[model samples]
Structures are given as C-alpha cells and as structure tokens.
Target chain A: MREVEPKLLKPLVAGFQLEKTLTKYIVSQHNFLYCQKAADLDASVGKTTFTLLRQINELQKILNQKIMLYRDRFSEADVYAVYCEHPDYEGLNDGTFVDRIEDMCELSTKCAIKEWNKSQIRNEAKQACFLFRERRKWLEIYKTIHNETKTVWLAQRHH
Target chain B: MSMPTIPPEPHRPNRKEVIIDLLESIALEEIALSHILNAESEKIQAFVGECLNFPTKPSSKEIIKFNKGVTQLLESVVMKEWILLRKLENVLDFEDDCEPHHKKCESRCHCSPCHSCHFPVCKCRCSHKKHKDHDCYPGK
Candidate 1:
C-alpha cells in the first residue's frame, strides 16, 4: 500500500484549519452584532437601531466575502467536515443551517434590545446590565473556541 | 477688534464608516474560523483511516467514501453560515438605492491609478463624477 505523503497531508491539514478559523470568526461576529443590535433597539427606536442594524449588515457582507475566500482556499470536503462538527449544527437541516443561525442571531439581537427597553421603562437596572454582560460572554466564548482550534491545528502540524 | 470664537465641529462618527470597520473585523474572524475547522476535520479523518488500516488496509474507494461523508457535513455548515452573512448584508443596506460601497471601493480605489491618491482624496475626485452618491468613495 502506498503511504500518504507528508506533503499531501500538510496542505490538507492546513486547509481544514483555515475552515475552522473562518467558521468561528463568523459565529462570533454574528453574536456580537446580535448583541449590539439588541442594545441599540432597547436604547432608542429610529437612528440608533438603524445604525446598529446597518453595522450588522456591513459585518454580514464582510462575512460573506470571507466565506467565499475560504471556500476558494480549501476543498468542499474540508468545509463540510467543519460544519458537521460545529455545535450549532445539531437539529439544523443542511439546507437551512445558515439561515437558521442568521435568523436566530438576528432574533436574539432584537430580543435583547426589547428586553433592554423593557428594563429601562420599568427601571430594572440589574436586568438591563445583565444584557450588556451577556453579550460580552458570547464574545469570550468565541475567543476560547478560536484559541483552542488554533492550538489543535498547531499540534497536528508538529506531530 | 475682538475675533469671534468658532465652535468646534461635533465629533459624531460616520455611521457608514463604523459599519465598514465592524464588517472588516467580522470578515477576518470568518476566515480564521474556516481555517481551523477544515484543518481539524482533516486531521481526525486521516488518523481514523490510518488506524483502520492496521489489520487489513481499507480499499481506496472505501476510504474515499468515508472521507466524502465527513467533508460534506463540514461544507454544509460553512455554507449555512455564508448564507446568514449574506442575509444580514441585505438587511443592513441603509441607502436602498446605493450600490455596495465595498465593491465600488475595490474597483475604483484599489487600482494603481487610484492608489496614488489617498482614500479620501480619491473619493473626493470620484464623487464629482456621474457616479451615484453611494458609489462615491468615502471621504476621509
């Protein structure tokens, strides 16, 4: 049997690592925008929401471009595996996976905003404060995922 | 004669510029995530295939099929995220009639001729032309 050459393995591993990084980055961004949008909605109705939503939209565009770039860099096979292993993938149909996350992220953002508004009107300072802190938590999770995946990639390469 | 004092301009940040910066950061994150996911999956599959080969080597076709399933799963996830990002972009278009600034910027500003001029300087030049206001390069 012919051995799988180290040369072939190197690129393959590298490609997968790239895909993982892209996915986590995107998810984190989505979460960040979601929280920001929520906070904006809670604070005011018109320009603030519009501004945050607009920012979210812009982030989405960048995300799209990055996705295309990564797709071009790696093979379909590499992309697929990453999707399968993602925690968010569970209970999501393959066709609707992206839409689901996008929708949920947007909805969550709006919800956060609504909650913020409610707390403000009711003067529930603690709840309002929690919303801000929760968003930061999501960001931290994103960073953790990114760091762990990077460490894994390094280990594979060296080993 | 005493000179009249002029009030400083308000320090409001441009909404569009803020959006662009946030988007760039998100895009970078997406690239990093994809890189890690793809690499990890490949590593796992390779290790599994090697282990299975201990007693009797699996046929190339069998290994390929197994690998294909794994790859498909990952691709689907990535695609889903891509679609979400696209939808968000669509929703965020503030100036409904305006062309996406990024696309226009890439073409008109990044080229060698435009590079000679700084971004704001080039944008000022482009805005004077027949181009739509949205398409005009953002002035620094």
Candidate 2:
C-alpha cells in the first residue's frame, strides 16, 4: 500500500551504491579484479571495525554507569573508595585484603569473566577485520575495564 | 596491520558489482537520512547527519572530492600499468611470431641460468626477473 520502500532497505541500497562509487574512486580502475579482493576485504573490515567499536562503547557506557552508581551511593560514606572521575567508576573498600579470601576469590572470578568477554570480542574482531589502531583501541578499552573491574572486584560487597 | 581474511573466492563479491551496490546503497542512505531529518532545520540536521554515522556512512560532499582526487590518480596508475604490461606482452608475442622463435636471442640471454626467470620451466612465456607480473619481454 505504501508508495516508498522500507526505510531500512533504502539505507542498504544507498550503502551499496556508495560502496561502489567509493571503491571505484578508491581503486580508480574499472579493471580492479586483482586488488579488488583486498579492497573489498578492507571495506568489510572498516564496517566491522566500526560496529565493534560501537559495541565496545556501549559496554564502556554500562561499566561507566555501574561505577557511577557507587560513586553516588558512597560519596559521603566512611568507606575507602578509588574513584575514576572521567566517565567515573566509584570503587569502594570492604575492610582490607586481610578480609575473607573466599570473597576475594569470588570477586576475582567475576573479573576474570569480564576479561574472557574482552578476549572473545578480540578474537571475533580479528577474524572479521582487525587493524593495528583498532586493536590498540580494544586493548585500551580492555585495560580500562580490567582495571575498573578489578577495583570493583576488590571493593564490592561479597556474600 | 592485521590482515582481513580474504573472503573465500566463491563468497567474495566482484569489484564492479560491489561498487555498483555501494553507490546505490549510498544514495539510498542519503535519501533515507534526508527524509529522516526533514523535520529538523538545516543546522541541527547537519549535526544529526554526523551523529548518525558508523564506520562507513553513505557518501558525503567531502568524500566526493576525496574520491575524485584519489580515483583519478588510481585510474591513471592502473591504466599505465596495464598499458605497460600489454606492451611488454606484445613485444614477447612479436618475438614468438618470428619463424624460428628467437633461437638467436635464446643463446644470448641464457635466461635459464637466471634463478628467477620462469623461462627454464616454461619455454614459451618469459616471466623475467625484473617484472612483477608474468608479462615481460626477454630483453634482447
């Protein structure tokens, strides 16, 4: 009944058309059969990279929120907390390391799970289209998450 | 410099086809965005356009200019390489056309002695050491 195509389909078509023009523009030759393979791979990689970063950014935001919640909850409390201010993560202190190691073990395990997630993403990303800078970025994100999560692991209330 | 796995040969889209598809997709994206942003004023819409971007957003004015410059240079290089390769091929073909097929130059070059030359294995085609591709003349 509608005169126009679906909104999603339109962008897809547009992306395809744009890819063509850009490839031709990038490769310049109508006869790009040889280099075309690499070029297409590169394009696909770029797309995948963009998607990966966005997902990572989403994850970062979630972590940011978690850290922030604690920041607000314990800002005025007597607890010792390590605060990451930029997109802040509020780390709290639960007595000290002299506390139950079982609780510490449990927390460490959770942080390990997050580490596993980061590696899984890297593995998938590399298979698709990994670049040095992008890889570096993933590392940075991982490190940020790892450090914060470790802090969270140490500071979170253990059951 | 992580290598993007070349999609297996069967799955890989042809460059021409990919290019055409990309162009269409790009146009569609712009039009879609245009409609999406039609409600907003030009200034805010422009910001919206930038915000909506992913790694590969559809075509924009800047890309057009960049494409033109890069495409022109790329086109020129590809054409030049093709022409040069073709010329080299023709010269070899001309040699082959000779009644006896370069028995004279054959002794002179001793191409078989060259480690890189494929001439020893395949007598007909001369993939000389200097050239990157299979197309080359057996420098007389």
Candidate 2 C-alpha error for residue A101, in Å: 72
TM-score of each: 0.24, 0.17
Alpha-carbon local distance difference test for all models:
0.39, 0.32
Worst 10 residues of 1 chain A by lDDT: A1-10
Residues B23-85, candidate 1: write the lDDT tens digits. Answer: 444445445556555565445444344333312344545434543444454455456555645
Docking category of candidate 2 = incorrect
Report the C-alpha lDDT of model 2 over A89-129, residue by residue, as the tens digit. 11111212112222222223333235554445445434322
TM-score of chain B of each: 0.35, 0.28
How far in Å is the alpha carbon of B84 misplaced in model 2?
A: 34
In candidate 2, stretches whose alpha carbon ends up further than 4 angstroms from where it belongs are: A1-159, B41-140
Global lDDT for candidate 1?
0.39
**Local accuracy of candidate 2 as per-residue lDDT tens digits, B60-131:** 444334334433443343343334334333433332333232343465544332244323322434454444
Residue A35's C-alpha lDDT in candidate 1?
A: 36
Q: How do the residues A84-138 of candidate 1 rate in per-residue lDDT, one tens digit apiece?
A: 3443432222323244234433444445355554433233223322432343343
